[model samples]
Target: MNRIEQLLPEEIEKRSFEIISEELDHMGVILPEDEAMITKRVIHTSADFEYTKTLTFSKDAVAIAKELIVNGADIVTDTNMAFSGINKKALSRFGGEVHCYMADETVAKLAKERGCTRATVSMEMASEIEKPVIFAIGNAPTALIQLYNMMQTKQWKPAFVIGVPVGFVNVEAAKELIMETELPYIVNRGRKGGSNIAAAICNALIYELTRNHQ
Candidate 1:
């Protein structure tokens, strides 16, 4: 089995099979009594992609940021420290416009020095940004709720969201948000995946999309 498959717990594996079956049923993909084989195939298919990588935090963020730019992301939002760092290098290397949102002025200034177009913690500005924004949120559930509500009110339907909530608080929040919104997104599994992991997943998606496009 691949690394991801090995990482999957028995419960998650069972749950994934159920979800796949439900989705197939919804799509009218009828199947016979070969449910066990189908489940194995589903698990294998799910594990086909490599989602995470081990890199220095900065390198990880930069890699993801480049992918976002390539995939036509105009504005990149980093609500946490690690994302801010990654987004900074990405903005510099990609030389496109990027916006950094943070509660701390120091972080914002750092982001600015690294080539961010605007750095602020203002939700209003975020709400006003145009569509197809790339949102990277940390592990705070309250923050996720607020952002989601803000986007809903503004009618700003993001094209994609990269959720990498690292700690206990943010990880649960991220999972809940994913299950609730069902929006198109990429997420890291478990609390072990902090800002860097989230950035990496976003990077992987960007790379995947870019390769597919080319």
Candidate 2:
């Protein structure tokens, strides 16, 4: 029989991080403070420690993301689930908002007319936002590909990007494409990410901002 530890509602998250930190230490994994914060949150969300190896970050990606959020940059996600999981209230505190255009009627129409996936068209729509934007893409490789093209052509440059789409298709290749660029990014290097993980990373950054203000 397994013994379940009792915890208060507020204590659960703190305790979870305690366990995550202990396990990381036991495994001899050492990470920079900011990286460890994001990694721990991802592990807390997925209960998978393999992220310690698979999660890749461009230099100062976490710091850049936090600064963007602080400057009221908005976030665009590939899936509604990721959009919904973000803490809108906390983001609002920093004058930021989260958006997901995947369900927009216009995006669907454009994708159909162009014969491209809605994810592809959605990136184009996101580019038109007249503000600094951070993209959190976790379910569509097409979205990542589109962003890569947009960046290469100088059509749009995001403040930061989180590319962790999950699947067996072009998921790995898409991640590689983003990693090849000089843009700031945090990507799970293989095919093991999902919308939920993407949201976890966003929320981790938001939570860090909130913690600092407190």
Best prediction by TM-score: 2
Q: Which stretches of candidate 2 lie over 4 Å from their true place?
A: none
lDDT of 2 by residue, 1-214 (tens): 3597787999999999999999999999998888989999999999999999999999999999999999999999999999989999999998998999999999999999999999999999889989899999989999999999999999888778899999999999999999999999999999999999999999999999999998
Please report how far candidate 1 places residue 147 from its true position, in Å: 2.3
CA lDDT, candidate 1, residue 206: 42
Candidate 1 CA-lDDT value: 0.48
RMSD to the true structure for each prediction, in A, is: 12.5, 1.2
For residues 86-194, could you state the per-residue lDDT of candidate 1 as single tens digits? 4444443444445555655665565467553222233335666654466665444444555566556765555455555557654555455654564555444555444
Give the TM-scores of the predictions, in the order they appear.
0.48, 0.97
